[model samples]
Target chain A: MTDRVIRLQEAPFDYGAECAAFAERAGGAGAVVTFLGLVRNDGGSLTRMEIDHYPGMTEAAIDAIAAEAATRFRLDSLLVLHRTGPMQPGEPIMMVATASRHRAEAFAAAEFLMDYLKSRAPFWKKEHRAEGPIWVAARDADEEALDRWAGGAG
Target chain B: MRVLYFAWVRERIGRPWEDVETTAATPAALADELAAREERYAAAFADRRALRVAVDQRLVDFDAPLEGAREVAFFPPMTGG
Candidate 1:
């Protein structure tokens, strides 16, 4: 069985602490890879970002993705953490960590997790700018990123 | 069944969730039924291409069967990261 840690929270997470803890728990895994996503200010107009999610479905969707990544990569461990609710620009929005015996597997799995989370997870983001709030649209590039993993590109 | 809306859909509908009694056999049928009930529902679901659906908390197509489904959700495409 693959060990997985998944959490969906409204509070901010400490990236450094979470990385250390994940690496420690991964134990004998020779390689660990982590990714962090932060809210960005576009044209310095973004004041804050509001995230909305289906309470139960969001967790289920993320768990399914993490489990798939673990199996595909033969990972020793995996962690996925995402935050919902209002957040300021520059604040950390989410993180994913993967561990495996080889660096290649760890890196690929982390990227895969990110690609799936970006487009598949049941989370919606709205940017509150100086003018008004607007819901962010799903990017076609994200769907293309996910497709690469299926065609042996990743 | 409980019908839930989120993000702009929720904003457009002016509520988060509602219980509906319907004979619709599929999500598309259900959407049509709801759309006929009110202008808000029609507006929220006007563009099918902009919306995504889930049956019983799992994402599914509009043509997905609603048999034994207790919940259905409608929202815009996910923009998570």
Candidate 2:
């Protein structure tokens, strides 16, 4: 059975603690990989970032993504944690962790989760700049990243 | 059905969600009905290519059937990471 943990919260998360707990729970897995996304100030004028998400849909979308990753990669465990609401530039926005019996499977699952989170999840971001707040546009690169995994084996 | 909006779409439409009663059979038909209601919706949905739709929390094409769908959400491409 594949273990899964998914969380969407407004408060900050403890990355180190979460990692340690996940490692403990994933016991005996040969490989574990973790990816963390941080808010970036592309224009150097970004003062804050705000995330808006559909309350009922966000968790459902992430759960479906995690389930797909587990089946495709034969993962032993998977964890996805994302933050919403106002945040600073240096704060952690999200994290994905995966465990598998092999390094390749673990790495691939983590990347897959990240790609889905970037484009498929129902979350929107707005950057609060020194001048004004602007909604961030979805990038073609992110879409391409997700498309690469389509109809492919783990 | 309940129609929901997010991001810039919500800003432009001036609300988060609304309850609508329509005879539309598909998301595209519903879009047409909403667009005809007011100018703000027309402008928000002016470019179908720029918007994405979800029926019952699953992403689908505009032509996807909305039969028995309790919720329909329209928003721009997701920018989550």
Candidate 3:
């Protein structure tokens, strides 16, 4: 079966391995755009970070978003993986790679995927700062990102 | 009537999750039920300004009905990425 999205257990994501996986699927594609999200060290002093999700809801929501991206952008293949639960700094939080016959489609789809993931997915974040763990609120900037994708002058 | 708090909402509420029973048949009613639970719940739900809720796995507004939902979740504006 053709696979477009993959969400898996929290582990050290190997970028080389993941890129190879994309190339394997991109045999007939001319261009590929990949975006990797990592836990920011924020000056290299973070103990750990935690991700909270709504289980079944999170997967379903992500799948739906991928489906939407596939429809909106002409893509040969798409890969998306997100991690949940507790995680330490420098860990791979999520990845999005899109393959297409042209760079425009691949890049647009990758950007679109990240933008949607930021605003639409049901994931929550808590930062483990030196002071203590603090819950971060969703930023208006993310919402504006979506609006820009929708052709608004955000 | 299992109510879940996720992410920062769970933090604000001082828990990872919670389950409660109420006579609420709609999302708004459930919010009311939660708001009336105790000082903590009320404080957690104090400003309904940016709070988002979900019935089952689907995002819905506070006025949405919850007739047959197995889970109801509450959280702040989503920050997923």
> Which candidate would rank higher by DockQ, 2 or 3?
2
- Write model 1 residue lDDT over A22-121, tens digit each, in one string: 9999989999999999999979999999999999999889988887887788899999999999999999999999999999999999999999998889
Q: Which residue pairs in model 1 clash with each other?
A: none
**Segments in model 3 whose C-alpha atoms lie over 4 Å from true places:** A151-154, B14-19
Q: Interface RMSD values for the candidates, listed in order? A: 2.8, 2.6, 3.2
The DockQ values of the predictions, listed in order, are: 0.68, 0.71, 0.63
lDDT of 3 by residue, A96-152 (tens): 899998999899988888888887788878888888887778888888888766751
Kindly list the per-residue Cα lDDT of model 2 for residues B1-81, writing each as its tens digit: 999999999999999999999889999999999999999999999999999999998899999989999999999999898
Top lDDT: which candidate number? Answer: 1
Name the lDDT of candidate 3: 0.80
Docking class of 1: medium
CA lDDT of every candidate = 0.92, 0.91, 0.80
Give the alpha carbon lDDT tens digit for every residue of A46-130 in model 2: 9999999988889889988888887888889999999999999888999999999999999999998888898889999999999
How badly does each model clash, as a count of residue pairs? 0, 0, 0
Off by over 4 Å in 2: A152-154
lDDT of 1 at A69: 88
The TM-score of chain B in candidate 3 is: 0.86
The alpha-carbon lDDT assigned to residue A17 of candidate 2 equals: 91
